[model samples]
Structures are given as structure tokens and as C-alpha cells.
Target: MTLAVPPTVPDPSVRSAIERLRQEFPELGPAPIVLVVRTCREELRGSPDGALPELVERLARQRLRVSLD
Candidate 1:
């Protein structure tokens, strides 16, 4: 028997949100994945290719909220 793994589908909401953010802030490069789960408030994951401080500030300004565990 072969076990099939389901393909990952990108969330529409997250894509839309990222698009909007990009439109607003083009300097942010690319928006990290933002997950809004029921249990948690909001989570931002993935690393941006750039300076750590700049990335942090950019994400903050874009309002991409995230919580670490």
C-alpha cells in the first residue's frame, strides 16, 4: 500500500493579505506567511533575506503580527 501525502494549498486569506501589504509597502521585499488560527491570535513565519533589524521593522510597520509559541 502506498501512503499519499496531500498537497499543500496556500491560504487565500494569507495571500490576499500579503498582496495588500506588498502594495502598501514595496520595500518589504516579500511578505512572510501569516497564519491566523482560531486558538492563537496571529503567527508570522519564514525568514526574510535581508538585515534582521530592517526585516523586523518592516514586518512591524506592515502589521504582520506573530507570536512565538
Candidate 2:
């Protein structure tokens, strides 16, 4: 009998986004915090100061709460 192996998972873009956020907002916790970038282009284009508030609100609406630790 042959053993089956599980497929590899792709690295989530959210992780990098969260890391950048942590660097930009040191008061926030580490990159393990969940983050969803609604608009990738907008996030990459805009300043972190402007982008973070929107990202936080969007995630909150989805009931994915985040906090600075």
C-alpha cells in the first residue's frame, strides 16, 4: 500500500501585510495577527497611515477582531 501525502499550502499574502503593519505600527502585535487586504492595489499604493484604518474596519466587520499586544 502506498501512503498519500498532503498538498503543500501556499503562503498567505496576509502574513506579509500584517508584518508590514506591525513595522509601521509598532504598538500593534506581531505578524501572526490575521489580516485581509480588501484592495491589494490600494494598500500597496497608499500610505500605511491611511491604509491601516480601513483594513482594521473591514476585518472587524467580518468579525475578525485584532488588537495591539
User: What's the TM-score of every candidate structure?
Assistant: 0.36, 0.30
Model 2 clashing residue pairs (backbone): none
The runs of at least 3 residues in candidate 1 whose Cα sits more than 4 Å from the true structure, single-residue gaps closed, are 1-7, 31-69
Query: For residues 1-69, what per-residue lDDT tens digits would candidate 1 score against the true structure?
Result: 122232266444344445555565555466232222100112223443334334434444434433221
User: Model 1 misses residue 3 by how many Å?
Assistant: 28
- For candidate 1, give the lDDT: 0.37
Q: State, as a TM-score between 0 and 1, how close model 1 is to the true structure.
A: 0.36
Model 2, residue 4: distance off in Å is: 29
lDDT of each: 0.37, 0.41
